[model samples]
Target: MMNDTTFETLPGRRRSDVVYKTLLDRLYSGQYARFSRLPTERELTEEFDVSRPVIRNALAKLRDNGLIRSVQGSGSIVLYEHARGDDASAGQVSIGDFQKCFEFRVLVEQEAAFLAAKHCDRAALDVIRQNIDEVDRYVQRGEYRIGKSFDFHRAIAMASENPFIVQALDRVQDFIGFKIYIARSMSLPNPVERLALINGEHSAILSLIERREGEEARALMRSHIERARDLFLGCLPLEVVSDREGR
Candidate 1:
């Protein structure tokens, strides 16, 4: 139900990205079911009014994400269930690998938090606060909330007023969502506690920003992320070490 105006305002060379998202939305909403073949590339080109390369790029992304697969003689076949795999086993996350990724995030996000404190306008802070409130509301209702929680962090990144920081966090938001989902799926206790801690940390960072105390805010943010990383790792089963590389 997205309109042309929605697509026209997309930033960067992201027209193809808008197409990819539209296609993904359709697949997830059962516009195409499992094993249902999609339209031919030419047909999709006409439908989207995009070039073949654009359509191919969109479809190629779907394939890479395991949402669909293409056959030599046949068109792209829907693989809606492929993301979960046959056994419902998620891809493995090694302790070391997870730690590395977390460390990277810590380094990047701490700085982002500091910059946000220095640069964030009232409007940006309001956006983050609203996102936090939404997460709290959803959590209290026992509803699974991922996207909104991700948006909270994304808002903070944007508030940092650094284009690079914003872009880096945007890129990793998907991984952060996956990690949160893994924790939730495992029935980690104190999910709300974890979320609240993040919210509190954000608030503290905002306060520091209001006070123009960037360095202290940065340090606090680092500690907060590091602790969060540890907590996340603790929630996983000890067998995670053996499941490294998702094998």
Candidate 2:
């Protein structure tokens, strides 16, 4: 849930406009992942202390901008598909590339987890645990919160005590981030359940890591990435999914 204090009283700006832009920034920044439900109109009204009409107008603007779609009895669902880029003409990555990135993560992140289990200190493990907790809060609020999800994976890489592994993961971070968004988007009507399950996996892997169970952590990480890859690819058009297994 968005903090009540997140809304600001901008001098001379329309309340609806401020609300719209604030929500837009959150959508673009992955605070509200694609396909996740925005807070209810009443909830927004209370949070922003604005009239219901103002919240409706703000949502209308979001719909007009192709940022969200309204569902009868279901509130607004996010439609912002990718991260914002410098140019409007930024090239879209091929679906194949998305799958390949998952493959790369499975190969590298599994080993990273393995190494982290052996090399991770209490401080580093704490960071990963914190990321999991953050995701839990967002899930409980019915948001996917992809940014923290990425942080969880990156923290594991850092915990591996291998700078090269961390750099390697960074190279594909954006693509993998999109994969998370798309997967969660496809899980509409039950996104919270899906997110909870994924976060559960994160907690399970964290426990294994904390116990210094390197091989078990490696296997779990492999399964985790592979499962995520399959879920995301399942949402794509048949021809767009280049991997034979994905098809």
Candidate 3:
């Protein structure tokens, strides 16, 4: 049986909790069958009269809880039954798998950052600078702003002048954002130090790009991503480390 108390705190829930209860009832009643596709984002937005971001947040929560999976280029599919036996539910990432993910990121983002330096327009540079400033503000205020940080990276990726790189970044945005958020939330001591390091790296990359130093930009990006991989590994629990290695 689902934990009623904990369920009330889910993303779609409110003080009144109508949406939470409705969804939970439907889920338990099997209205969304195993392996069935959920309503599209547009459909859900229309049905609920909520903004797309709110709907996306709700779906993200569902996905994290193993109730659903969003297949890229397709749509969200119900995975409740499958999750009963799925390793994903345990939130494990193997070391090798984690390294592979970082490797892939380095390969793509270094080129993307270099191209962004080579081809980015003044307007795009302004956006990137603004994002960096936003991160600075959040850090100075001791505010946790993982979303803003992710947006900064996304802005850089979009400015890369490569459509494929933009698409790839978009696909992993949620995963990357959530992992950072989780790491920050779980930190025992001075999370600000780590966040500051990240901010400094962002500034370095942006500065290189603004100077039209493509090779320097690529080098900085590679270092920045490798650092992120290390931080993520440090933040993961022992059990999750095993899972990450397996992946």
Candidate 4:
């Protein structure tokens, strides 16, 4: 581990941005262990002398950057780990981490979608449908439920009837939760627009799966995930997803 590091207070930065950046630097320095829950919202609110919403927004930024994850009643867990100079104690989710996760998703999930086309029954598709509708409800209220989207994807993974694929996705799901939100947030800034686009994609995938069109389902799933990467991480060229779709 590297030596203990302290975050300096910067002048002229938004209070929430200050809190977010401070926490992030601490993360990059390995002050927080991966998978460990952070302080409660109340505690952070007091520590930062900010309102709950400020603390929430700050944490939201961390989540958007894929440096932390939210857990029910447990607060956010730190996921980012990085090295500076000779300090190589690794754990944080950098752009490199995001890209690696995206690559894995493209690899594992595309096949999962393909297999799901062959094996998915009405029950499995119903789970996805329910979750997608729930997501739309959240978006309608101008909120984004990252967990809901994760559930939708996991439903597809389960429909594949492949334990190994399901296991692999579960391993990285906590982190995947953040990226799902971030990509959706950036690619579709308007809640209504995002709701329509996300549900549309899910519907298309499910339709192809129901028809047992494995190859088409596979390609569309790959493209869908790649579209997210392009939106959130700029992994592919700009033209890979035109502004119309990303918007």
* Highest lDDT scorer: 2
List candidate 3 stretches off by more than 4 Å. Answer: 1-82, 87-91, 174-189, 244-247
lDDT of 2 at 164: 93
| Comparing 1 and 2 on lDDT, the stronger one | 2
Report lDDT (CA) for all predictions. 0.66, 0.74, 0.66, 0.69
Candidate 3 residue pairs in clash (backbone atoms < 3 Å): 93-243, 93-244, 93-245, 94-243, 94-244, 94-245, 94-246, 95-244, 95-245, 97-247
lDDT agreement of model 1 with the native: 0.66
Candidates, ranked, TM-score: 4, 3, 2, 1
Per-residue C-alpha lDDT of model 1 across residues 93-124, encoded as one tens digit per residue: 45666677778778888888788878888898
For residue 110, model 1's alpha carbon misses the true position, in angstroms, by 0.6
Worst 10 contiguous positions by lDDT, candidate 4:
1-10
- Which residue window of length 10 is worst by lDDT in model 2? 238-247
Worst 10 residues of 3 by lDDT: 12-21
Candidate 1 lDDT score at position 180: 31
Model 4 C-alpha lDDT versus the unseen true structure: 0.69
Winner by TM-score:
4
